[model samples]
Target: MGRPKYFTPNEVSLHSTLGDLWVSYLGKVYNLTPLVEEYKGDVLLKPIIECAGKDISHWFDPKTKDILTHVDPLSGCVKYYTPRGRFVHVPPPCPRTDWCNDFGRPWWKDNRYEVCSEETLDEILKRYLHYNSHAHSYTWKHNGVSLDMSKTLSENGIPDEDEEFFDARMDRDLFSLSICLYFNDDLTEF
Candidate 1:
């Protein structure tokens, strides 16, 4: 009934303390303070401890084996449980390259796009337009709509070169320009 709220990573960081735990997953922010308090003594705390106040998109990614599992201290039974909370939409961090595109092609082989460190939003836009125009082999869609990458980027404001915009779009399940410098190649080697 009200306007949706958004928070920057810095804002989420303000609530990172254990007493006021908050974490971001898939561009959604969740306050896990209550769950942490409830499961204080459970082994489930391990994953939570690792992800508190951080963007946990990778944890939920299908390609990765980063699931949260807990062991019952008394019975030695292992189980998995995710924290429950009132999650708000926030821009998520960039995803891993392997998870960026549907195609099994390596990033370099796909387009050889290199996100420049000093690249402006305009530069990114130009690259997107070029990619969309020339690369017809792959079609990127959001909510079943074939994305007009240029139109979407322009509509969102072209001057925004901050990493936040990229993260936000990814979180919203929008288009992914995994070609950006924000997602470095330091991850798993191809």
Candidate 2:
């Protein structure tokens, strides 16, 4: 209901992961992370996973506001044209009594998943201090390299690649890029 948030393609690309997947469609950005959690390990998630953090406007029709359709050459039947392969919320090629539609609104149409902007390292540090009031001065580092407070994580050469680890079925915490925070003594504090 507030002002709509805007994000650059580069910023969106930073969230490409099962833990934080995002995609833009019809000029609207969506955080499909919940969908991934709900339908984890489903093959239908393959296409969506493959397109994480990228624009999926081509996956949808501009006018219909839905996935594009094509006539099947084999059966001459109309079906959702998913060149990337069928994904979640997309009904099967044929009617099935077992198909459940109780999910209410589909992920694409739900506005709750719409995303916003990001913050710089300095802003994040401020937030950290806000939560940890006992902290005085602080130093942020990635890969043992001191971070430039004015720059973002990506701008500082730290790419969020949790998705790659997830796709490889590896534990993220085991090999995740962690930002180390060193508490500095406030020499002037009185």
Please, what is the TM-score per model? 0.35, 0.57
lDDT of 1 by residue, 1-190 (tens): 5333455567677777768887765445677776667557655366665666777654453323234455657667654434542122111123344332333542212222221122333444455556554333344443444445444343534333324544354443353344222223233321
Candidate 1 deviation (Cα RMSD): 18.9
- What's the CA RMSD for each of the models? 18.9, 10.5
Pull out the clashing pairs in model 2.
Answer: none
Residue 63 CA displacement from its true place in model 2, Å: 1.1
lDDT of each: 0.47, 0.78
C-alpha lDDT of candidate 1 relative to the true structure: 0.47
Highest lDDT among the candidates is held by which one? 2
lDDT score for residue 105 of model 1 = 43
TM-score of 1: 0.35
Which residue pairs clash in candidate 1?
Answer: none
What would the per-residue lDDT of candidate 2 be over residues 1-190, giving only the tens digit for each residue?
7544457677789989999999977656889998999999999999999999987876776667778899989889989899988888888888899878788887887889987644677666555566776444667888789998888777999886644554575554477467887878764321
